[model samples]
Target: MTTNRTVQTAADAALWLAVHRGWHVLPLNYGTKRPLGGCVGCRADNKPDHTPQTCPCLARGDGALCHAVWAATTDPEVIRRWAQRWHTSVWAVHLGVSGLLAVDLDTRPDPPPHQPLNGLPWPADEPPPADGLDTYATLAALSGGTVGTDTFTTDTPSGGLHLLYEAEALRWKGSHGKPRPGDDTVRTGLGWQIDIKAYGGYVVLPGSTSKAGLYRRSSTTTTPRPLDPWLADALTRTGHDRTAAPDARPAAPVPVLDAQTGPARYAASALRSACAELAEMEPDTGRNRKLFRSTTRLAGMALAGWIDRTTVETALAEAARHAGLPAAEIRYVLASGFGRPLAVPDIRSAA
Candidate 1:
């Protein structure tokens, strides 16, 4: 297999990932992680009712590449056609289709807002983790395994890491931060800022360039190593393993209904409607904007004591996940919504 270090253009990188790495590749928007605009028939304005699963273009497999990740292909001809049709500076490898998994350790601000242990008890001997990398190192130490830096690795545009590993026979589910219903703590993946990328997830191919900077190979190893047993165990414990049906989506949390009257009922109804709309959002559409809008509304309600903040976050996260937004984007949208100030309903009037 040709080393990714030699690949220059996004097209070449896509080809290399498909042909050499045996991975399904797809084109992303130039200098951005977002997907390219859909074809005429599949555009949001043209067919607002259609989703990736229901799109006729995808069903026909006419190689339209309309649904982004769903259109990922190992076919060299399709990739070449995409390269010609779209100006792609970045591309992604579909991990599920490629039978691979990645541990994404994101860089966090100094004195990170969330703790790496999440809600779990931390080791008394170890100091607090400063970032995802540190959290991962702590997990490795606890699991009796060293961090697998020698395997295939890429340095993200941000000062973070992507550790690629072969997922041999294990069908795993991807997770962002652990946003469980009724759990208010800001927990993420196995630890804070750590994410698991598996089925229904993708990682940017090495050599892909984005607005922040270039994603380049950080390790000399050309191939991904088989997942370490300890790491695999960690993934299973953290809810990455798919034990039941493969197509099953995580059940969305039921919004808290402390009271059936007044603003409480209104807030619950609003939460359900917002989540449903979010779940129905199509790929490459205004998903981010919709998420921001929905979350802002819910955050205001939570602040007004009409709803639980954790429930709102959990519902939104799951709904956005179902809508196919990436984990990182979901987190960002949630944070933005929570931080923004919005008008709250007049509880006295409703009462």
Candidate 2:
């Protein structure tokens, strides 16, 4: 088993090293993708969040990391203290927070059975042309650029790809970016499988470790180039145009509810709970991406007879708008979620 001390030491080194090179770092809890918490008094009783604290004492001593992204910093001391406090942490740079962006590409021929890629662009029966799924080659074709230059790249343990590029600005332009179901931020001309991590987002730093496994710097080149504008265009454009959804839907797990009330009803109740959860997230700050993941699971419940399609759409549309999503964005996001396979917990199982 990994001990906190050993993990913390590695984390401290990686974060400081990144900061030394001018990258802002947020130390997330090891094996998870979120930052450490503030004192108990300030945290949500159930879920974790990244919000600053109001208490003068804590605020004066250390900025509350309750809002994970807000705590992003280049300050060496603060990072060191955080690492020491949560020894089993890993590094996740605040993308677009420090003039950095990442191009995440999915290279897997087929998504792992357990981790389906929801909302694919093609119909379930008609998969992408064998060539369409080639991440690196397609990137070059769409972006009019090559990944051959001396740029920093990380070979993700999940068999995915991560390439680091220098952005001209500190963050992705908020006015131009809209979230897609894959947590990809797109412009009008971006392409499929190319996830743009810009402002209001985070990606594991190249040297980080996670439950997924260690992320290794696979390429020798350390210098990065400005992201190719064509690539940006493709990331934006492709995200908007795709209409096909996934065919990953499967029968939901049977709910283990009291027989008197019926197990199916329990399943329906669970779906409603999920719908409420997604609809409550703030869309202006990464809501659409999360909506895709949540809805994918909820869609399974609907197919399982726990909820109706109309009810799901109505509840989702209302919530999407509340999160500041526009109509087109909402529709695309919903369709993507519907196409995805259900991946949420069983309501009866919760009991």
Candidate 3:
């Protein structure tokens, strides 16, 4: 929140971030978000399987700045040494080390006509969002929350927005390093143009210049606000909470099949049981396999005309989501399960 000091260079920015904000800082290649290539001994060709955990470079503490964000440090002396070594380098803040979570809202062309953006279902009464900002607003509106204007916000070179929030108490899997194939633009499961930077992730600090332009503060407040409750709920719902565990109660109550009997009742009962099991699964503990199995069973029932495919999909999707599987993963597992040959016995025969 301190604004007394001026940041004239990347080193200055890094120092301010470390001294003023207590954020862990790293050196990024000038004009790019990439970390400087590893030192000779740590290069990929020298050691293809090299990792910071196993490499001797990190232990040496020689201020080599190897292993990208893994080498982020708040030590002023080390940062100053980095400034001398990589004079033109920009600054990057290691989000996890700094206990920050940044919501990156990107600007891009809307999806082509007819195809849903990120295959996400939009509200029936509202038009699809045009960009990450719009998508964020839509999400906030849906969650009975407002877009936080008081948080620490920054504007990227490409006219995108970065909303930084305190996330010291929360932890999630994954990183914001390199983009995966076909996922370069929008982050899967979160939204169309929004990306989350959390554990194992880093964000370019404000005042750092890149190829496009400067990353500058856009908010009046310089400090990151506490994570909004609604936004936290959204993150949890979208599988961003790795700490989530199975609770005593089911995620959702099993609907009563009051009007159904015979084969229909059997199919509904199977679905209810599957959903219950899914809702109680532990994180990273074969949730995908469980979802696929349930999907396959319910899919077979749908194929046998004892249950509706849409009904099966909706219920299973909700259950899997509650189990902390991301939306994209849920869809992929469902597709795979549905593609398999029908293997379930006819409900009438079972009855």
* lDDT (C-alpha, whole model) for all candidates: 0.77, 0.58, 0.73
Tell me, by TM-score, which candidate is best: 3
lDDT of 3 by residue, 1-351 (tens): 112222246678788879988888888876557877677777654566677777788777767767878888888998888876666545788888788998888887746122222223467787766777877787787779998779888899888998889886338543231223432223344666778888888888888776677788889987899889987887776667878884565345354454266767788988899988888889878888888888887788788778888888877876776676776888899999998836767555655
Point out where model 2 deviates above 4 Å: 3-9, 39-63, 108-133, 170-189, 235-351
Using all chains and alpha carbons, the TM-scores for the candidates as numbered come to 0.62, 0.52, 0.65
Taking the tens digit of each residue's C-alpha lDDT, what string does model 1 give over 23-42? 88887775457666667767
Q: lDDT of model 2 at residue 54?
A: 42
The positional error of residue 269 in candidate 3, measured at the CA in angstroms, is 12
Writing each residue's lDDT as its tens digit, candidate 2 over 1-351 gives 455654665576556556666666777776567777755655545434423444432456464575566567777777777676666536777766677677676554533221122222323443343321353454464346666546777777777667777775443532222234443322222334455566666777665667877777777875566777765555444442123343342222222233234545655565556555655566356788876775786688777766566766666665565455776877898898899858545556677
Worst 10 residues of 3 by lDDT: 176-185
RMSD of 2: 16.6
Error of 1 at 241 (Å): 1.6
- In model 2, state the lDDT of residue 127: 34
Best-first order by lDDT? 1, 3, 2
Count of clashes, each model = 0, 19, 0
